[model samples]
Target: MMIYTIRASRPDEWRAQRTLRLEALKDPAGSVAFVNTYETEEAFADEVWQQRAETQSFIAEDEVGERVANVAVLVESGEEFEEPQTHLVGVYVRPEFRGGGLAAELLGAAIEWSWELPEKVGRVRLWVHEDNHRAQAFYTRLGFVRTGRTMPFPLDESRTEYEMVLERP
Candidate 1:
């Protein structure tokens, strides 16, 4: 296993973000977790990257400086009774890095980032494939509990996702 480093992503690394995202989308398990296709991710504009990096995004890089994972934690402002929250998205660690604690590290980093927001995010949430036991276990180990929230995943008709959340300390 290679020793990898993780950091908050930068606007200039949008291309790297695009590349790693596509690679992650190509993974067999990715089809269930992500809705974006390779081409769609690859085509994201620089403006999108700039806004994301400045506010909420992180990336994992290999020893040689290539991006291998990209995770984003975005906050959605709430209107009446909406209950503002932070959402976890674009979480992908290269297949090669699986089982090396990279996913947990990514989630921890995102959690840490959300805690630093001045508004103080109350909860962090994400949608995970209903049938993905591997992911469910991983998330459970990290303190995410099923909210009993279910919705049809946008990308696949046969799959459903459960909303899970971890509250801020």
Candidate 2:
């Protein structure tokens, strides 16, 4: 059986975080799933990676100590929302580790962290590509509902993305 642990990432885990992100950016859905490209992220400075590690990011590590999955929550503020919103992003699981509940675990960590924030967060939100039905179903199964908001995909403006949200109770 495979053994793994899910937990928050530390500042010193920048290297591991970068490695995992690079792997995610190479996946088939990477173009639609991530706002940034692997080539762009590869050029980021070490400090950028460190800052990412310091964010509310969680990682799933295998028994051999390799990071196999990651997710993060960012508290966002804008005139469009009445209260601060917790935005979940950077969700990815290595292909070999997919379908093992790792994505759910990562999302649970982000949701739990959002609820524990110092300030009140109105809800948790995430964007999934419109063509990615698998991800849409996954988020729906976790209690998120489509908000009917659509935005142009950054990588390909011709395509669209949908916003899904889970309100805080």
Every model's TM-score: 0.89, 0.94
- Per-residue lDDT of model 1, residues 1-169, tens digit only: 6788889988777667766777888888887778777677667787875665665688788899988777888887668425667889988887788898988997899899888888767888999988778988999999999998899888786779999999877
lDDT, candidate 2, at 73:
77
CA lDDT, every model vs. true structure: 0.82, 0.89
lDDT of 1: 0.82
Superposition TM-score, candidate 1 onto the true structure:
0.89
- Model 2's alpha-carbon lDDT is 0.89
* Highest-lDDT candidate: 2
